[model samples]
Target: MSVDSDPDMFSSQTTVASNWSKDERSQKDTFNWAMEMMSHGQYLPLKSQASLNLEDLQYSTKMYYIRQARLACEIVCESIAPSQGIELLTQVYQSMKLKTAETKKKDAVTDTIISAYKKAEDYTTKVQILSLIVEKYSKSELLSFIEGLTIYKIDAARKYASTHGPGQYVTPPKITRLRLSKQKIHHFIEFISAPCYLQVVGFGSRHLKLSSGLTVKVPKVIRTMIASRLITAYNNYCKDNTILPPCRATQYKIIKACAASQLKSLHGLDNYISDGMESIDTLKKVVSNLGTKGLQTSKVSDLIQSLDTLKLHLKNEFRSHLSTESDCSQHCMHFALSEKGCEHTHSNICQPCDRMYQIRDEIQNVMTSNFSNIEIQEKEELEHDILVSTEKNLGLEGSFY
Candidate 1:
């Protein structure tokens, strides 16, 4: 019989054909959905869970999932409404928290790795773990955490190097390189002060460039190092014949002497009169003893006696000057307060004493107008003179003794 005419046979064949077509269409849709999910990074969680055992999951794989989740959250926030995106992000954050908790459950292994990284003894393994942490965490947090770790590590390394001798327990080159790259130069500079810093500078002199451009402060211990370095450089220049320079050791002794002299001066005298007298005596002695060898001893003695007479005359003049200043101050106070017809006088209340009051007011006005400028000018002049004297002294030949 013809298929079109045979109703039962046609109905059975149509049912079989419809079932096969539906099955093929379902398979194609499933394949396409899986491909789409993979393209959007959505298939990793499912694939990881299904194909990998919990023990077989690598740290890199976990980090990949974390990164993808963060990126997906960001994309959703940007492309969709904020509220909906926030809700999705919260779920992603919860997932991250769970993953972190799972990782933390293996505390013994993780702690071992962290300890190794901190000791910096296993360079390759430490670097790997550090890379993983840097990749997984925010850079700001990573940097801050590393900074604190570095401080402890530096102190420990210093102690270890000191105890074992530098040759025996030197910091690993790789760790040093990494630390230098990560550390701020200023902090490193501050950490390395003299005596303690001598070895560091000796090793890293080429790497260090201390200049005005560096705003980092030098500590007191290192200030001596800076001074010594400057002195050594000047000495080298002197050796090259650029200028005459004093013996550095002798200069140091001179500085000590000057400090001692200043302390003595502070406590020994109310004024510098004794210092002036002592200087004059020293000058007279030097001049007398250092005179021409063949010259008459009598002439030298006469010169010294004349210097003594001059010194006595100067002391008398200074005393007289001080007495005059005291007398003038007393006389001025008396005149301003007790002169006849003075407005300041208790008995001169009549006639208002307008002229004297006016003169007094004028004097006050003049003093007020000129005093500050006069003091400023005097200070400036004194500073200029001191600076000139210093320059002249520096330009002179320096004594080694």
Candidate 2:
């Protein structure tokens, strides 16, 4: 299937090489140009007269050779078994030096088979890749994929396989779309790219179910809507208005890439998810989990406001008396020996360092300590332990006396 091994496909005639003195690049150009001119598979002829004339003069090959090669590529490729195409390409390329008149004709024919083999390889690979990526595509996606390849790829279809080439054309010539205005396109773009599309936007997003039975929980502060929802909306709007909208590729590109600044990420809900909110949710679940799942906390919604308490405590209670230039060294020099300041080197926190020990202790209590039993039971247990110790000491005192 590979074309690189074939010798006759790009053979240089001795007379032409010696007299005309064309380089290897010129040889390749002439060979490809000749093959293209004779090809039936939607090859575009040189349009400009100057370009055409330049090619004819530059190539300067026999018409008979071009004809034989073209016929071998288009007519002969189909006439033989597909396996024969590869075989002929290999056989003629290896055996023929193409110095004599007969060998030159063999060389030209072999050149044709090379093109045929290349087409075969290209077709096989195209099918293999398309098999994997062909998903549930809306009409918009198909248009974007084949945007610029208008007549070229279509013309390159298999003519021999079917009775009619790619079936009959359905549309009338004049009714097809020509140029779409950017004026109309901007409407769709602006609709999807805006912060909030409907009246319910801003302040907070309320969770709502679409008519299609999909649930959308948008971000309270930022946009958390899915891209597919917007794409579906665009399609419906375009259909209702009888107007052409941009393809899904264009719509997706605008949001994911083109308008990435306006719309931050793909998963709309991830943008505003803070650790504080998550902690509050976890605590609320724990409170509800108590009482054998009967739920004691009636005001679970107010748990969200606990973040404000942490902030207030940090702002009001943490009184670090040290100035900007006064680092740990100056603060701890009175209580420590090392110039590195009071490393305080305590188990929990540094004393007189941040003055936030109470806040730290409270945070640790909420996060790690269990508050299941009431404080009354703990106080009773401590009192019992002290009384027992006192009794034991009194017995020892009596023995000493």
Candidate 3:
């Protein structure tokens, strides 16, 4: 009886194994057919059909499918940029995984494929692609996916090592103080270093506005001036070796104060003054250092003298030009006035009475010059004649008197 039961049990076990084998073969066949269709651009017919269980498909089938997709990508790439190929590779990688196992869990797998592709090139375009992925995908999923792809493809594997693999550049390397946290630091660098116009208010009570596309290397003199104001800011805010973080409205005030203080400290208070606005004075006081107080009086005096000289020269040139214009206009007006047909009337004048004033001024100046010289000559002759008469009277004594 025991021997008979054993044969029966063996038959049952064999039947179960046979059924499992059949299922496996069927999945493998389905995967093979899917891959062949993909190669021939014949996937349209199979897109919606759930004809096979991917989890049941043989591992060999999945590998061949991936290889075919990669080859197809390469063929397309030969005629275009590798980026186009990589994008296609990424899509195909996702589609294959979609057909295979857990759809939701494939994100990690797909991300890994993308990272592997990026590692293939250190090109700027590749780096840009990686940056986009980093922003779009979760960090852990991205790291894990790259790990898996690298296992079979050693170059990808090596590149993965460069980041997560051993002997890679340090994960979070030492950077400048400003770049302490990668994300925050990068943002700060972009913000502070961006080319934008600065609208400043408070230096010498003026709302000073200036646009700067200046780089890190500010001129020594300008740097010194700014440093002086920074020193004031440091003293006022009680910090050193750092500038105040910009905060919208407050930024303009702080910058203006700092700039004013620096200019006054390094050059002179008067040098930074603007007549245009009233806030600059308040800023100047805010940034002013008690210890480094007064502006250099002598320099201010010198600048004043230089300005005065320039003003005088400009005034003389202006007056001379006006005089020349007036004379020309006067001659033209006189000619017009003297004409018998001048009865056409001033109503026809284009530029108004300003031209009449100019003409009158020119005529007066000309008349004054000519009349003054003649009158002087006549007066001298009268004096000479009086002297001659006195001399004659003296010579003739009482008779002549």
Instruction: Go through the candidates in order and give each one's C-alpha lDDT.
Output: 0.42, 0.41, 0.39
Error in Å for residue 66 of model 3: 41
| Each model's total of backbone clashes | 0, 0, 13
Candidate 3 structure, TM-score to reference: 0.15
Candidate with the larger lDDT of 2 and 3: 2
Strongest candidate by TM-score: 1
Rank order (by lDDT, best first): 1, 2, 3
Give candidates' CA RMSD values in order.
25.7, 29.2, 29.2
The estimated TM-scores of all candidates read 0.24, 0.21, 0.15
lDDT of 1 by residue, 1-401 (tens): 79889999989999999998777765445544554464474433323322576357788887775675565456555455554766766776789876765554323544565565677766444444454343334434344445445444334444444555432433546632222232333322332222221222222212222455654432222121233443454455345445445556644543332211111231242234444455446545443433442335765676566556645433332222121112332213334343354333233221211222332233234334434454566435534533443333222111100
The true-structure Cα RMSD of candidate 1 reads: 25.7
- Residues 1-401 of candidate 3 have per-residue lDDT tens digits of 57576898879888999999777765546655655554465332222323467676678776655565556456554335544766765676788865654443556645674755656665433433444344334444555555443222443434544555332333456774332345533443333222111223233242334457543422222222233333233333323225444333343444443332222331232221122112222222222221133334553344334334433322122112221112333223333234443322232232322332332233234334433554566435534433443333223221101
Question: In model 1, what is the error at residue 399, expressed in angstroms?
Answer: 20
As for lDDT, the candidate ahead, 1 or 3, is 1
Q: Which stretches of candidate 1 lie over 4 Å from their true place?
A: 1-10, 25-28, 31-86, 89-93, 100-104, 107-401
